[model samples]
Target: MSCSCSSSTNTQNELHASIMQKINNHPCYSQDAHQHYARIHVAVAPACNIQCNYCNRKYDCSNESRPGVTSYKLSPEEAVKKVLHVGGLIQQLSVVGIAGPGDGLANPKQTFETFSLLKKYAPDIKLCLSTNGLMIHKHIDEIAKYNIEHVTVTLNSVDETGEIGSKIYPWVFYEHKKHRGVEGAKLLLEKQLLGIQMLVERGILVKVNSVLIPGVNDEHLPFVARKVKELGVFIQNVMPIISKPEYGTKFGLDGVPSATHKQLMKAQEACDVNVKLMRHCRQCRADAVGLLGEDRSDEFFKESFADKSFEELAHHYDLNQRMKTHENIETWRRALRAANGKINQEEATNKDELSSNGNTMLVAVTTRGNGLINDHFGSAKEFLIYEAGDKAIKFIMHRKVENSYCMGKENCNGTYPIEEIKNALSDCHLLLTQKIGDCPQKELESIHLTCDESFADEPIEISVLKGVRKHFFTAS
Candidate 1:
């Protein structure tokens, strides 16, 4: 029983200037939006000690813990009724993270009893947490006695002098042996830079999620953004290593970094400093919640743990009673083949030959600016088509604007001409644009030389391409 925060330097600099103006008006860091989607992670502590080969505590290790992944383990009165049923169906619940299947201070009694029942029932909820500072210097007084205001620390390398943080976090259990490589990444980067300099000298706002990993720590992300901006760490989320070949893990088994928009704006201009690089991170889970890319986890699993009706939990998981039809593309391909099963028969026959060839698949879904598409016929609207083979096509563009062109840049008016996105892929010979650029993939392969071999060069994990097109082409 210890959680208190109110030093009130004008209410912690107006809550760190309204969370750095919502992380510079997020769309996952301003691609003006194309799905960096978030909606509170909801698996409380399954278990994790430390072993990051690109994580696999069975699939809940927002930091560590792996095995068949399904630790609901709920109760702080079932997580404050799933955070007021996901804060009345989300607009900005902002953040309430634990970041686990494990390690919210290594599940400190279900992470401080779910942040003391969301500060005694959702006290204007906004408490983000993520850890790997191996039990964050013994729960910095239960995360400043629960005034917990956003802390992410997955410091891939503060000192394990590379080789991908010594082949992904070699081992760290501390005082109980199991300390390998750069002696357990220099004792977990010296207790995560002494819990990020005691949560930025107790102002309580720090972010540093570095996972980069191309040739391991892409030259150590500007030395991990100049050592978490000399421990003041306002933000630095350099993520991109979610390597999963069914969790064998050598860090997402090479070849995921297509890294364009001029290589993530030249690694955010070579991490010049003054931290802040979170570009709308969907490296989420550990009870994630809405308003970055919007998931609202089935309206917080039907108003906090099912009273029923997402068509009665999709007819009790027979799943696909038109997936309760709303965010369609067959309701995001039947909720990504029921949360990761199968759906990529060349993106379900390029959405059935663009709906048997009437040809209209325009999705623009913007969050804004440095989130990258870099103009390719950009008035963005078409919306439906999915049959990636009989002449190749997979269009799902949706951005008429609903908040995140880095949070409405003076109503973002600009984009569309690589010739109007190759004249909307000129009645498709092949085109599957889920955010592409390298100068619009050499101007859409010089106008359709099979539009970069029918997409999926990357960024199509909408639940492992709907579980590899529902267990190999819509259940045969």
Candidate 2:
């Protein structure tokens, strides 16, 4: 009996270790892995079978980089060659993926062919595929055969009734016919959930990517997160809808703004109860390369950045260096103040009414750069201040502060000098960040400062406006 018990325990331990090994190197699914591992995507698949109201795959020379924009497309053979070259150069490359310029499974021949070459050339490397989930069910056999371990299904909504789905996805081409409106969305959702279930049953790790559309699926994504969690998805990445009028998608042409940071956080707060929300994804392009948060595709492909050494490339996109407080701190402050003054000039319209009611507020956002609330309160080196009222919001200044919290051991009994940090933010009414600790939360409250950590990677202007509206006007 003792021997049998020991054997059982050993077996369980080994199984747990195996699972951890599978996820420890996947940057998209494992947030911790992002610090060390790099992933490269090959845009071998360009034919999408479904029409998302937000997607328009037009390639141009524009310096802008986002999902659905791949400057170069390669066949399976060409893709394998590029992968080999990149792999040889970047030693940390652990995972190779096929995300689209279109759905991976939609162009099955090219998709699987790329996988086949990858397995042959670099069998040790992890294989991942991202699909819209419309045709994922059809390729399960090949997926398993290639030992594809991670799969991402873009499931915007799980509404079987199509009430919300019809608005997000206008049409899907499935089987031999085209599906439109609510019927199309219903069909896509069915297949998406079914595909996820099949992958789970096959012992494959699944991640669900849901684009948080402002009015259409923003509220619905948390529910989708809950449902996918039930279907055995390992994590959920709720991305903001990146809309541009030039792309000419219905949502963009109608001027639907991207999901602001606050909105994503609000939705994530709900989803957190049911599923683990992924906050580290860069919403990478199909041909994206290098570290998860930073895109080095241009350096690798576009000759403008020029220096192609892996170390030099990584240094070029380093966040700590990018977020460093400029040496001439006063000059930086002056520039920020001048920019705010111009914005204040245009926004002086409805300020009197809001100011009279004490609704005009100063918001301090913890960010890393590029107008995103991408830092944690405990890790923040400076806070970007913005003045927000009923009608307008503008960047005002950057306040430098020490990270007083999260410096000591959690269980250790010690004094935390939160007041030192509080003094810098005393004029601000609210604080926004990716996350905060309970002790710090209570400390901020003691000073009558509202600390909100629900938001991440949001534009400073939009985040300030939304934070003011949600925290100030909602109760009134």
Candidate 3:
């Protein structure tokens, strides 16, 4: 069923109450609350079902301050811990979100588990989920059941582009199989729009995040805005495309430059005619912490790990060493917490320099959550892209390769084409992974891609900042 909004019988106060009750404190949905309140995203959903050419989910989503990155992924229990811990520290933290290092609904078990736990621990905090909207139809009932106040669904294109109207997404996994090209894009768009319609019918606030890929979807977004508005989306967030050659997205590799601020504003202005435009978005990460105006994810990570080294905590979450996907890390965490209390007590005396600014270099990190550089280069299915400037580093996108060479049983007989690797990461200046073989390493180097194995034990922000300074700035 499509959204059927009515206003004839509704009073102005009734309308205001409905809107405020849902978005009064949601920073992303409400512009007024952005400065006054804080929101934290727990990266509990590490799996994704769709593949966007523009994303490499290997780095924290705080890229140069854009969103779609997280320092690490967490189990639902750990997510609850981080929320409670950060909530105690940041009094203004009014919202807890599961936004993905991947699609939130794609990992419903993890997303709902985290949400259920939050109800028990931090009931007052608003619950939010950000999904690609492929699985939204299947999960809409659960979303309403859980009282998820806000949902952000990314709608890249609605006007059909022949085979695949939306060049933004390449494939989607639905009904347990993969659908590619136009069919996949069509299926995704159908579900996304239908899901938004369902949410609106449920009286849930919906925000549409349309990535303005100029020359690709820029001309197509106004159509999207009108369609989504008809479906009852409360606001439309027209975000700029951060495409760069070094980041290696299909669009980036094809030499698609990021949309300028002027172009972005223009797109928002055009879309605003149909829907309420969200101009105050920061594009926060899936595991973002702190207020909407100020991100404290790095600071929170440092404080959380003050007692234990990243390497020590890595043992619990290393996908290579673990038998169960979500093995109980509580015992391991308890031991670490005992050790950290004393260490953090001493370290708390000195201020941590977890600033976000640094030289603006796009760096990709290989990780399997747990907030550490743990994934090997060849086996990595996702690469989290970040933009690191002198003062701060923020996550931007997640690049999902169809298949990693090392994931198959084949040896390095050049099975992974050098061109494919080059195309995937032509825009990135640095690649951070726990390990890389000589062949892939050399192939990447041939394309002017620098590799860093030294960041294996560091937090994402620290590693990227240090690497950017040492690798790019020191030479300058």
Score each candidate by Cα lDDT. 0.51, 0.74, 0.71
lDDT of 1 by residue, 325-357 (tens): 223433453443454333222223223543333
RMSD of candidate 3 to the true fold?
A: 15.7
What is the alpha-carbon lDDT of model 2 when measured against the actual structure? 0.74
The best-first sequence of candidates by TM-score reads 2, 3, 1
Model 3, position 285, has a per-residue lDDT of 69
Give me the runs in candidate 3 sitting further than 4 Å from their true place: 1-12, 60-64, 161-166, 302-476
- Report the lDDT tens digits of candidate 2 across residue range 154-273: 888888899798887778899878999989988988888889999999989898888989888877777897798799888888887888786677899999987765676567666767
Look at candidate 2 and tell me the lDDT of residue 76: 85
Give the TM-score (vs. native) of candidate 2.
0.65
lDDT of 1 at 160: 52
Best by lDDT: 2
Ten residues in sequence with the least summed lDDT for candidate 2: 321-330
On a 0 to 100 scale, what is the lDDT of residue 383 in model 2?
Answer: 70
List TM-scores for all candidates, in order: 0.32, 0.65, 0.62
